[model samples]
Target: MVCESNSTQAAARQLGINPKLLDRGQQAQVVAEVGSEELALDPEIRALYAANKWLAQEFDVLKTALVFFGQLTR
Candidate 1:
């Protein structure tokens, strides 16, 4: 299936197969071939991205508070 997880007709078309038939046939192969390592990594990658987003939001809030408190000293 070599698609890295994309099973769309466009993926099949790129491989030179007729698009309509490719969908049903390759689906099973793709699922079977996916490694356990990949399955484990997917969640880890998603968690890292989510954590990064949260840290960025928190830093922005802290920055705004710092500015507001600094102004109070004047």
Candidate 2:
């Protein structure tokens, strides 16, 4: 709601809550709880997670290759 709305206070008001309810501490706690729950996954999601990690590693390698070639050209 905050991302879609022009103002964060307006977003909270539309949700029928105070703007202070969107404080950083509350958001951090919510993220930690959600991340913990999400990581408690079954085998299928675990496979996907492993694949995502591999892809991220491949992307980092590609970025390093780009930098190496860019430096060689200069």
Candidate 3:
């Protein structure tokens, strides 16, 4: 996962939340923002972003499935 080290500081300044809480909230906000942007994108650009998001989600799903299967087999 990509980490945004500055988010906590930025969120604290903008939202007046504690740094730790700010970090968590900021991460959620970022995800929401990405989702909103994806939905709002023009059809021409949507395909590119959709493809990228699909690949990343697929990787995450496959990785989690593998881990769960491994645990079940053990």
Candidate No. with top TM-score: 2
How do the predictions measure up, each by TM-score? 0.40, 0.43, 0.35
Per-residue lDDT of model 2, residues 1-74, tens digit only: 22333486787788887777755444555446446535533446556666887999999888889888895342
User: Candidate 2: what lDDT?
Assistant: 0.62
Q: Give the least accurate 10-residue stretch of model 1, judged by summed lDDT.
A: 28-37
State the TM-score for model 2: 0.43
lDDT of 3: 0.65
lDDT of each: 0.61, 0.62, 0.65
Which ranges of candidate 1 are over 4 A from the true structure? 1-41, 71-74
For candidate 1, list the clashing residue pairs, or say none: none
Summing lDDT over every window of 10 consecutive residues in candidate 3, give the lowest-scoring window: 37-46
Selected candidate, larger lDDT, 1 vs 2? 2
As for candidate 3, its clashing pairs are none
Per the 3 Å backbone cut-off, how many clashing residue pairs does candidate 1 have? 0
